[model samples]
Target: MFSLKAALAVPFAKFIVKKEQKWINNPLETQERVFQDLINDAASTAFGVDHEFASIKSHADYVKRVPIRDYEDLKPYVDRVVAGESDVLWKGKPLYFAKTSGTTSGAKYIPLTKESMPTHVAAARNAILSYIHETGNAKFVSGKMIFLQGSPVLTEQNGIQLGRLSGIVAHFVPKYLQKNRMPSWETNCIDDWETKVEAVVKETLPEDMTVISGIPSWVQMYFEKIQEKTGKKVGDVFKNFNLFIFGGVNYEPYRAKFESLIGRKVDSIELYPASEGFFAYQDKQNEKGMLLLLNGGIFYEFVPADEFFNENPIRLTLKDVKVGVNYVMIISTNAGLWAYNVGDTIMFTSIKPFRVIVSGRIKHFISAFGEHVIGKEVEQALKEGIEGSNFQISEFTVSPQINPESGLPFHEWFIEFENNVENVSDLATKIDAALQEQNSYYFDLIKGKVLQPLKISEVKKNGFQTYMKSVGKLGGQNKIPRLSNDRVIADKIYDLNLIK
Candidate 1:
């Protein structure tokens, strides 16, 4: 949408360019003005739906009155807009739908639009530029980079299908950059996500590739298959490739495993892409990235994560954010998401142009048992415990499940113990202790902690990941989201001894 429709947006984009000039030079300080402008814009074109924002006459009033919204709340608005109603929530013909495995629900089909296309594009370019600015490296501008993205060849001309976004990009990418794109058409379908990936293997393995990008899990899978096929590993194939860029999810759990498998040093790039919009990215020098919103395309709002959002929630400006506190990223985008919560919680690491770290998903918390434990809280506790106790943990999965017999829900942590000569219980106690000290909520509400005395399961040699992978999911993006806060997947996961 960004590159292909460059012509249509030139004039409108010029206006956007003019508006964003002030913030363009690091605009985190102008949050209040941006947030108001965004709300006003949404009110003016409330999708032709009988929606809340449609009747708003003043942007200020709308901004003052409207409550923050989540995906589920917005889903109804999306349904109306897609069904051909004009509402402030949606506008124009949907360019297409971006398919996502919804955090709460299993799948989410979000509508993309022409108006919002630039937001995605600009956010993307900004990420690249921001990375270059951070690292003082302009090598990307000269080299051939591979985006191991989904197949872009569309089954229909209308970009309304699940694969339409990827498909359209392939068909419309500036012809010059198209050749460098990775992943053949076969690997980009909903019919079988892996089948399409397999196709990318056949086409890319024999080639001399310099730079590669993709969801790390799939990329790693391809490398493993390549090694199995030719008796040579990732080091053999990617020795010459200088950089690896990936972002749909976290790679921290697999960072060491990947480095070991590749047997070479590769620059790793992390991206935080949203079908709603491409929000931020990681740069080389700063492990944390400066988030340059499609500042020109959409307006942003920040709500403190600790406060009750449904009640009298405090929405702050970019200037009000502290360096380490979590805030729910709300944006009123060109795509008709007004005061829409993107389900991500990021903390500002640096205020210069607002560099932040994606701490975790707001919904990625596990409190199925009434003990509220968030991903960030758990990660922090674990990191603290590791440092304090000097216990090494390779990877772990925290799932909340209801024991059929106990009639009470509990948090089960499938922990992967590192090579240590001593006791597993000691480490478990240390972790629990850390949590009590770090986050009191979890400690008070937690009923009983069950630590698997055995660190290794015979079915998988290395970690708890083998069981998750065996269940047909990518290690990076499709992690078993912690906050089922329900017993659904948790029970199923518990029933099957992942390793055995």
Candidate 2:
């Protein structure tokens, strides 16, 4: 069959693959050029003037003059931008404001400029293109791809479009690929997730779906709907399905269940896109780490994760980082965010070619007893616990129980199972053991009696969904947090537990 979409995508995809390959070949040169270009592009902007960008010729000067900041610190400038102010953060007003959760901090409006939009588009396109070039898999582009995305309905805030990043990206789908997209405009516009997913199942059931992409949990929900509707696995419904591209949440804990839902092994790709920028994506099939974007309209910085709470912490640029150190990712982007902390933590797995694996979130951790357990460790522990178990987990979260009057302080895990565990306590023990192996501080806390053993609270079916719905965060791009330092989110989940 002649594939017009494939034909149209191939040339540009190939060009991007080649370009990225060349760019990664000389890391230092690419970093230098990207930094210089970013500085030059924003030299005339208000932030540029205030920061004295004209005199900054070296990385040292740039680092010295500009301070590392989080979204709260950048709020004044973003406030000015939101008030229809031009040239406050970027050269001009942003085309859109990516509305996303600030987690415990509240909501945020991240600017998306003309210069920054291409970074997301190109990086996303090249991720697929790079995979195709490596595996000679043109079938994904040859057929329709069911991108489970948010509705591209915009609400104007100061004459600026404000919506989810996925929605914003959906509107910019290439004309050539639009024919190969799914759910229809009307179906996608449905605001409710349940209604939208059901409609998607009906719309996509009869179509050719070779590739499916979304957050892992939402994709799982879609697969469940397909199985419920057709009484067949996803692989049977879409036999041509060969690619599963996922992001937003760590895929490790859900990997087994995702594989079972599809009913067969498929090629998978992971991305690390935030509202601020498209930072990294899996570029190699055999590799364990994602290739960090160097030339994509963004200049990178890293602060040691452990030292981030300090009044002034050691900030390292791309040229100064070493592999294996956990760092809170910071970026200065063309989108008008300068030295902004995006909140996620990552550690470089390889430095020669610059590959990273997301470690955890800065705020999402259990350190009440100074155990300092993070999302990555918790995720790994969960994966280890479920290795040979018959049960599959749907969703889970952990929080510290620090009240001394309530017997002893312990970490509580609220888990919703896809299948019932025959020995829930045994699994919990294994998970606790696995966590101890990963973090010595956690083990010491347990040994010193500073914290009690990990306790499991098996939640009822759809417990997390119910919780999310109750909180009005049930839909697009909203993820169940893996770890909470306090009992704020976990206590609500505990209240929703019917199984306990």
Candidate 3:
């Protein structure tokens, strides 16, 4: 029955794939259309009127009128919308507010308009459809699929519903897949992540689960729970499980551990979803980067990452983006975000079809000693260091140890190893060398005797998990930072005695 359903869906999936290729081929034209639509639609809104969106003719005019803003900068307008003001940001009050915990700002409420909400659902659906079109594997669609996400329960502020982005997405799951979705609503609503995972393991253990999706770290906890309960590999328990859908963090670091936990490899899809917008997803299995959603209801601007902090940085449209250059992505969306800085930095791996890899966050970097180390550099370095080696890392984070109470200041890497290494110092040396090779400033700092080699502080078993739980960010789209500019996280980990 399931196989027949999958067979019937193939043609429809292919048709959608063919339609998507149109915008993919003409990226610039599609973006221009989206830009014009956003401007015309929101011209009467408070933000648009204030920025003279009616007079904006080109990208140049738009740039000249609207300055790039982060969430805090746009909060005043958002506050009006929250206070039930119509036509403040968008044409009308938002349908929902994606409530997320912000670093500087206590909590951020990103608007989800009627026009914008469907785009999120469509992007995710299209990702799966594209995968099926490419691989001819829609069998997973018929089988039970588990999405480890936040509670669907939402609170009302004024007249709009508010919830986590993932939670809001839950309410939008297609009707066809509702029957095949795992973990009961009661189980999902359980707020405690550990308790929820335990419930999910019990519910899914007896089911024929074919697809599992979540952030890798949280999913790792789920996988471990399954292993503990069954005393068998995840693959042995769920033989049909073949599709792993993930986002929030890079999967390369956890690939080895995941494979070990499953006792085999599985096809995976990487999605680039956020509260701001659903930007991109892996279109092809062998692709290096995600296919950027050019036709999505969002207009994009890219500023060179190096010059992003400048008084007046050059903001280039998709047409001007170059391969291999790090760029800070800015967006103007149908949801009424105008010239908003999403805080993520990306690099174009392919420009012909416009594919991008999320390089790092604009703020999540270690420049404590002027080395300017970014997330991509650290992840790549760790990946290189562990390749072909027996060292399997569960989780890790890096921070600058400036006043180390020892010799010269250095990078402190707190890593939770999946398996014990023969010599941790050897692993640390390899990682440090890789980091030095990737970051020239760090190399010069070390060579000039201003900074010492990076050190590894072994995190006790499940230390990262304990640290996350302690801070009330255990799961549900929460992720550990790969790099921190300061010792805030590092100090917290030490205070908890998570370091071995």
Best by lDDT: 3
lDDT of 2 by residue, 241-324 (tens): 999998988888788888889899899999999899998999999988899998888888899999999988888888899988
Task: State the displacement of the C-alpha of residue 493, model 3, in Å, after optimal TM-score superposition.
Answer: 0.4
- My TM-score estimates for the predictions, one after another, are 0.78, 0.96, 0.99
TM-score of 1: 0.78
lDDT of each: 0.59, 0.87, 0.93
Q: What is the Å distance of residue 268 in model 1 from its true position?
A: 1.9
lDDT of 3 by residue, 1-500 (tens): 46776986799799999999899888889999999999999999998899998999999999899999999999999999999999999998999999999878799999999999999999999999999999988888778999999999999999999999999999988898899888888999999999999999999999998999999999999999999999999999999999999998899999999999999999999999999999999999998999999887999999999999999999999889999998999999989898999999999999988899999999999999889899999999999989889999999999999998889999999999999777888878898899899999999999999999989999999999999999999989999999999999999999999998
For candidate 3, give the lDDT of residue 115. Answer: 95
lDDT pick, better of 1 and 3 = 3
Which wins on lDDT, candidate 2 or candidate 3? 3
**lDDT of candidate 1 over 227-255, digit per residue (tens):** 77778767677556656777765666556
Full candidate order by TM-score, most accurate first: 3, 2, 1
TM-score of 3: 0.99
On TM-score, the stronger of 1 and 2 is 2
Question: Which of the two candidates, 1 or 3, achieves a greater TM-score against the reference?
Answer: 3
